[model samples]
Target: MTTKRREACPNLEANLEACNCSYEPCGRKGLCCQCVAYHRRAGQLPACFFTEAAEQTYDRSFDRFIQTWS
Candidate 1:
């Protein structure tokens, strides 16, 4: 298995401004790529995929995403 390296996000500051993720202590907060990969591996969507209200639920499941839109 290949390990992926976590590098400093060049857009971290800007990304943080737009990030709506309600998870207070998430290490992947402003690292969009890592956040996406992590959630994808778990068969879920990232907080950024959800609306602000939905993101607060912290239910990153695909089903929840569909529910939010439906």
Candidate 2:
């Protein structure tokens, strides 16, 4: 896959401030676009969709997201 280099995002700082993903060392931590794309390809949702307590579970599944929100 010849992916283009990600441009420096303007919202990086803000995204980082709000991101709740508990998986440390994630390259996509503050990159919402990449994070969402990555999880979507894996048939999952990003941690931001869940509550703080729920995000800690690291499930990231659609069922988990729905269960957490609904």
Tens-place lDDT digits, model 2, residues 1-70:
0132235576777888899889987888778999999999999999999889999999999999888878
Candidate 2: clashing pairs of residues: none
lDDT of 2 at 37: 98
Q: Which lDDT value does model 1 have at 69? A: 94
lDDT of each: 0.84, 0.84
User: What residue runs in model 1 are displaced by over 4 Å at the alpha carbon?
Assistant: 1-7
Model 1 per-residue lDDT at 14:
81
TM-score of 1: 0.85
Task: Tell me the spans in candidate 2 whose CA falls farther than 4 Å from its real position.
Answer: 1-7
Give model 2's TM-score versus the native structure: 0.83
> What residue pairs are clashing in model 1?
none
